[model samples]
Structures are given as structure tokens and as C-alpha cells.
Target: MEFINIALSNLPVTPENNQQPSEGMQTGLDLKEKLSEKMKMAVEHDFFAGIYYLQGKYGHTYRELSTSRNLLQQIYREILEYYIDGTWVLLESAAPIILRTQDAKSKHFLQLGFRDLESSRLFHQRGSNIGKKLYTNQINFYKQGIKRVRRARKYGVLAILESRTPVEEKKEYQYVSYDEVRNPSITEDVKEYDRVLNKMIGLISRQLVDATIQSSTRGYPLELDLIEMHQDNFGAIIPDHPHLLNRFLSEVETAKFHERQKLPDRSRPSR
Candidate 1:
């Protein structure tokens, strides 16, 4: 709520004062993509936590799956609300979207506001062991967590296909291509999206930290060192899904390699 307020207050009143087309378009695209990814992460975490909540409710897993499936029914309703509701609306609206649909009983309203906690059940069943090679000791159930998040993302995207919202209700305004770049308000308004993403990440990060401290995860060995050892003993796994680009692994490997180089050759036995 505070995030929504700050974003609304900070937008440029007019596009004339902002950058020219190309630069603004690029910025808009970059922010749009980044915001979507952050939204995905937050929404996935929401679903994961919500599964725990439902389990507490003695909620039906099948019921949750059905609810997730039915969410598509409210997609346009959510889309309308998304455009009209907050800082994003300021790109065209002189005023923020006046939200009238706030019934707790309404599925549409629930999905929009409480998406993460209200989505499908977590870990419907034990999934395959994809991350086993990524570990060296007991096969960690972290892969189960990963699988749950993937399922959450699937459910969320199925419910809400588009990350972007329309700037206006008119036919031409239905879709604003980044290439059609006429709005400078887009640049300023999107900074709000960036902040919103940061807030979501912060929220998830803190929740994860708390969960770790409270759970068996606190006793679990650091997976980084385990992964490093596995990569050392077995060589690197070809395509680790999350590290498909391998940027992090390369840096870790280089650091360890240099550290090893600094050590005297123990192969000489007695010096």
C-alpha cells in the first residue's frame, strides 16, 4: 500500500519533459521485462506459502487445483483492474484507478490481491529428482521446492497471461507497443514497477530467511559448498537448469581455482 502511494506521487505530469522516443521505449521494455520476472518470483513464493496455509486450513488439494484452473475466468477482470488501479494507470489517467470491486467473496478480487497465497496447492505429489547430481550427500528436497515454484508459476501465468496492462480503454489504446513510444509518463511510471518488484523481493527474502531459521533448513549444510565439491569431484553438470547460463558457476570456479593455485604443490610430498 505504501509502495502504491509513493509511486503515484512520483510520476511525471507530462511526457514533453521526458526523454525522446527511442530511449524511453528501451527503458520501458527493460522495466517491463524486469518487473514481470520479479512478479513471477513473488507470485511463486506466494503460492508456495499459500499451500502451507491451505494445508493448515485442511483445504482440499484438488479444490485448489480447480481454483487455479478457473482463475482464467477472471483474467480480463484482473486486466481491467491492473490498468485502472495504481501508479501504472497514471500513464494516461490524470487520476489513479478507483477500485470499486473489493468483495472478499468475489474470486476475481481474491486472485488479484492475494494471488500468491490463494493459488494452487503446493507439492501435489513428489516430483522427479532433477537436482540429485547438483548435490553430493542425501538428495535434498530443495528440488521439491523448486518444482513447487515451477508449478506455481505455471498456475499464475495460466491465470494471468500478460504482465502488462493497458494504458487506456479505447481500441487503439488496448495495446501500446514499446515501438509506438509516445509516452514519457511511461518512463516515470515504470520506476514504480521497479520499486514494486524490489518490495516483493524484499518481502520474499525476509520470509525465506525466517522460514530457514524456523525449519530444518537451519541445520542443513550450505548447498553452495556441496555444489562446489560435486563440481570438483564429478566435473560440472552440463546444463543445470537455473544456472543454464553458468555465470555464477564460472565465477565460483574461477575463485576456487585461483585459491588452489595459491597453495603449494603437495604432490612433492617431502620438501
Candidate 2:
């Protein structure tokens, strides 16, 4: 995975080569540590929320899970800022510097938020007598989370692309023109970054489809609403990758067909 590759590439090696960690690397590590701490707190809240949900204490569930979800959203924004800031640094650097650590960290937090929100939605869906307002709110919250994460991923790609500077020109130029020249190494990095984000997006799309199917089976009949909302939010974000959207729609159709097959045949006359 690109995330793993980026993390491995940023590891501080022994001084045999007289190499030292860059400012970007140290900053990335510090930010990651802070974010990790925050995420732990969020997880605890989510756990308590789950317990409250199971105990039929939805009031408590709402308060605790809201806390957790808000924290995750805060972390998501921080990650987005990190990428945006990193892009500026990359654009200003005289030498080529890959801040994959920053990218990796940002992607990690986004993925966590994605999973947490999806799990929460599924958990709430399983409950009896959930109001339409509550269901709509949950779906909207999930959509917003998806949008924030996708934006972070987009900025992460920009940061990677910003780091593509020719080695020969580093000494002469104070600010490398990322667009004028394409470094092969940096090109590879961008490709790897896209590959990883694409995979993540595909996974999330599948999960959304699965969740829609599950909700429908539970009598929510949210297939069209959820699918349309997802396409509008998630699918619209990646205009370059229409295939992912297409595959998601196809899966929804297949799921609907199977679901229809499971229903009792009403065409036969009652005995």
C-alpha cells in the first residue's frame, strides 16, 4: 500500500550515511503522535456510545457518539491543513523533499474517521423505532465525513505532486517549478499515492453499498436515497475515476435483484 510505502520511506535510518531527519519529517511525527492521542479518546467515547446504544439509552448514545464523531471531524480538518501546509513547503523548497510521513498520517486519520462513521451508522440502523429525522441526520453526517476525507486525500496528492523537482536544478533555483519539470521518482510517488487513494475510495464505496443493502433488508428502504447521496458526495469528488462510481452502481443493482428474489411471490393466488 502507498501508505505503508510512504511510512517506510520516511523512517530515520542510521548515521552511517550521515543522513538526518528533515523539519517536515519531525513535524509529521509530532503531529501524528498528537492525532493518535486524540483518536484514542474518540475511540473510548465511541465504545461507551456503543454500550449505551445496546442498553437502549439512545440519549446517552447521541451525546457520547457525537463527541466521538466531532473529535474525528476535528482531526480530519487538522489532517487537511497539514497537507495544505506541506504543499506550500514543497512548492518553496529548493531541493526535492518527499513529505510522505505527513501524507501517510493524514490518510491514516481520514481512514479512521471513515470507518468510525460507517460503523456508527450501521449500529444505529440495527436499532428499532429509529426516527426518520435521526436516520437522515446520520446519513448526512456520514456524507460530510466522506467529503472531508476526500478533500484531504485530494490535498495529499497535490502535496506529493508539489515535491516533484529535478535534482539537477535544486542547487540553482530557490523555488523549484513543480509543473515545468517532472522528476521520475516523484512521478512514481504520485502514481503510488493515487493507487492507494483509489483503493481506499473503492473500499468505502463497497461498504456504502453493503450498508444500503443491509438497511433495506431491515425495512429502511434507503437504497435509492443512500446511493444517490453517495454518488453526489463521494462519486462527484473523483471526476477522473468514473469507473469506481460505475462499479458501485452495478453492485447496488445486483444487490437489489437478489433482495427482490428473497421476497415471497405474491403473483400466486392465496390458497
Candidate 3:
């Protein structure tokens, strides 16, 4: 996906202070710009990692993918800090786009990693000459990859939800007077972006449900448990389908019952 370039220059300066931005404001803008560049670099790394994986260069693939994940994590941390520190005002209308893009890129990479591992496993399975030790290592990698993907997906969902919520401007940021361009086109763009994001969230939630069900059916209790744990974090945003919603609630109750069963009976005196 292409990075949405935010036109920070287009932000209208307040009429009362038409002069150039203060040094502090300029520094904030520069930091935002640098963060944008970092996000672009992260996307580039993901692209290159995919290319390397397809070419069977496992070493290059691992390095690029690792770098991309690390860059994304750093960007997330910095963005959170900016929000907390009231510097997100300088980001203007670009904040939502940045958050959404980060979440989307994370989901994309997780799927890519899982797909690559599955393909490799199938290929090895078809080859009679594959060493047992090598095959065992591949299985181990695949299991670890699944855990990583699930964790990444959980984080991505949280990030996207954060984008959906409104951020209140801090009192300290009130001194910086600027208005976002009120163009109808920009307003429409935001609406469209929001619609797409909401759709994506619904899809992701359904996918999680499907995964949980599949894992349970396949008797992968550990995977099912992990997904259930993740599902609880964002269950509020699950799609509004009645059947799906009911099923999810039922599963939650079942999970709770199992937990209760495992707990010691406090009502009885200790042995």
C-alpha cells in the first residue's frame, strides 16, 4: 500500500499570527516528517522481504522482515509518545492515516510470514530427500511463526481501534494556533478512509472467529486458547452479525466456565 503523504505545508496559519511558525512548532513538524519517512522505510523493507522470500534467499528475507517489524514497533512507540505529549497536534490530519497504515502493514506482514512458512513446510513434506532434523526445525519455525503472527495481529487491532477513537487536544497545545484545511474533498477523503477501516475491522474480527473455530475443530487447544485471549482484547468491535455475535458470546461463557472449573473450591475448607 502506498503511504498517504500528508501536506503539512497546507495547514492554514491563524490570521492573528500570520508569521512563520515558532522554532518549537517547526521542530515538531520536522519530527513528524521524520516519522513519516521512517514509516515509508518500513513499508519498503516489507516489500523487499517478500521479494527475497520468493527468491528463496532466506537470510535476506529474515533480515529485511526483522528490520521492518522493528521499525514499525519503534514508530508505534513514538506515535504514542507524541499523543501523550500533545505533539500530535502538529501531525494535523495525518495522525489517523499513520495509525491505520501501521496497522494494515502489520497485518499484511503477518499473513505473508505465515504463508511463506506454510509453503515451505508443504514443499519439504513433498520431498523424500529432506532430512528429518531439517524437517523438525521447519516445524518448530512454523509453530513459532504462528505465535508471532497472532501476537502481531492482536497489536494491529488495538492500533487500528486507537485510530478510530478521537484524540482530545491538550491544554498546552492550545497556544499553537492552526486550522486543518476545511476542503470538502479532504472531508470526503477522511470519511472514505474511515468507512474502509471499519470494514477492515469487521473482516479481521470474523477472521479471528474463523481461526478460533478451526483451531478448536483441529484439536489445537493451545492455538485456540491463544486466539481466545487475543479476541477478548477487542471483542467490543466485533461485527454486528447476530449469529456471529451470539456464537462469540457463547464461546466466552464456555471459556469462563472452564476457568471456573480449574479454580480451587474456596467454599470448602483446605485439605
Candidate 4:
């Protein structure tokens, strides 16, 4: 019988130099494109929806809801179409129309109202929430739209900055300064740990996204950011799927364990 040697290459290799795992860079790029488009959708929706809300209120007072929805619907529809298609012509064509048409019902209601407060208020009461359910749909759409926009812009900025200034590998570690100088309390080991940890966190986030895609997972949000990680440069993408997020947390915990074992010990010698 011949003795055969087996390799333990099957085990996950712990990262030495901080870098993204497989498909991490491509995934990050894809995520950035998706986020930017979503942000555009959200912010535009917010703009039209806000204006529509004001117009709708006035229309409600006069009970011209059908006209109000029609007017605002065109604006909302154009805004969405522009967002999806990146067409400036839609905005140009819609702008004057929105300005001219959206407020007409409200103006009519106001002209009717100054003459009689009792009658105006009574009319408003009768028309309360008449178009509200449909109106609320627009409001909800705007709210979520803005949230997604904010989230995307945050990550988009981060990705932009990261692309511009890639982190250089350093033989000598750096430290966080208080005001302008380093704090005495923060030891060298802690500083090194922080550097490694931060880099690992960024990598783990990209990998988490890749893993989620690989799993072909469902039960995630329309466009969930698996990382749920945010920075000044990288805006917040709130966790949409707990299961996907857990994978990232798992990577972080593993890194922490390895760092504790590998890095220099932080302790004081008794005098």
C-alpha cells in the first residue's frame, strides 16, 4: 500500500494582506450602478410627489380630485419616465405644464373660498380623504424613494472616493488623532487592529453581496444592501435581509478572533 498525502486547502484561507475576496470588486461596481439609478428614481419621485401633495390638498378643498390626480399624475408619470430613461426632454416638456396646470384647481378653490369661509370649510370636510387613499400611495412611494436615494448616494460617494484614492499597503501602521495629535490611551496594537479591522470590514461587505447573489436568495428587498454598513463617504444602506447580513457579521467575528490571536497583546506589566 502506498501512503498518500492530503492537503488542507479545502479550508477557508484567512486573509493576510487586506483585499476583497472573489468577485468583490465587480459586485461593488454593479452595486454602485444600481444604487445611482435607484437614487435618481427616488429623488425625482420625491420632487414631483411633494408638489403634487400641495396641489392635491388645494384640489381636495374644491373637490376637483379627478382633475388634481390627472394634473399631478402627468408630472409624476413624466418624472418616473425621465428617471428610468434619463431623458431631459420629458422634464423640459413637463415643467411648464406642471407649473401651469398643477395649481389651477387649488387657485380655483382659493378664489371660491375667500368669498365664504363657512362654505369652504364645509366643502373641505365633505371632500376629506376623498382622494386620500390614492394620494397616500404617492406619498409612500415618495418616502421610500427618498430613503433609497439617500442610501444610494451614500454608497455611491464612498465608492467614488475609494476608487479615487485606493488605500496603500503600509509597513508602518498609522493612528487616529484627537484634534490634531494622537491620543495616549490608544496603543500601537489597537491602532494596528483598527487598520486591519476597517479594511476587513470593507472587504467583508463586498463579499457578503457576492455571497448573496451566489445563494440565489429570495426574501430580500427590492434592492437590499447586504452590508448595512455606512461611512461618511459611503452612505447607509439599511439591512433588508437578516440572513444575508448575518454572513457579513460572521466574517467580522472571524476577523476579530484572528486579530486577537495574531496581533500583539495589549497589557501592562506590574511594577
- Using lDDT as the measure, the top candidate is 2
Summarize candidate 1's per-residue lDDT along 126-177 as a digit string, tens digits.
2122332222111122223322332332222222211222225223547667
Tell me each candidate's TM-score. 0.20, 0.34, 0.28, 0.24
lDDT of 1 at 40: 35
Using lDDT, rank the candidates from best to worst.
2, 3, 4, 1
Off by over 4 Å in 2: 1-20, 92-271
Q: Any runs in candidate 4 off by more than 4 Å, and if so which?
A: 1-62, 80-133, 169-271
Ranking by TM-score: 2, 3, 4, 1
Candidate 3, which ten residues in sequence have the lowest lDDT sum? 2-11
Error of 4 at 143 (Å): 3.5
Q: Which is the winner by TM-score between candidate 3 and candidate 4?
A: 3
The residue pairs that clash in candidate 4, if any, are 154-235, 155-235
Candidate 1 global CA lDDT score: 0.28
Candidate 3 residue-wise lDDT at 21: 52
lDDT of 4 at 14: 26
lDDT tens digits, residues 40-83, model 3? 66666676677678889899798877776566544443433322
Write down the TM-score for model 4: 0.24
Q: Which 10-residue window of candidate 1 scores lowest in summed lDDT?
A: 208-217
lDDT of 2: 0.41
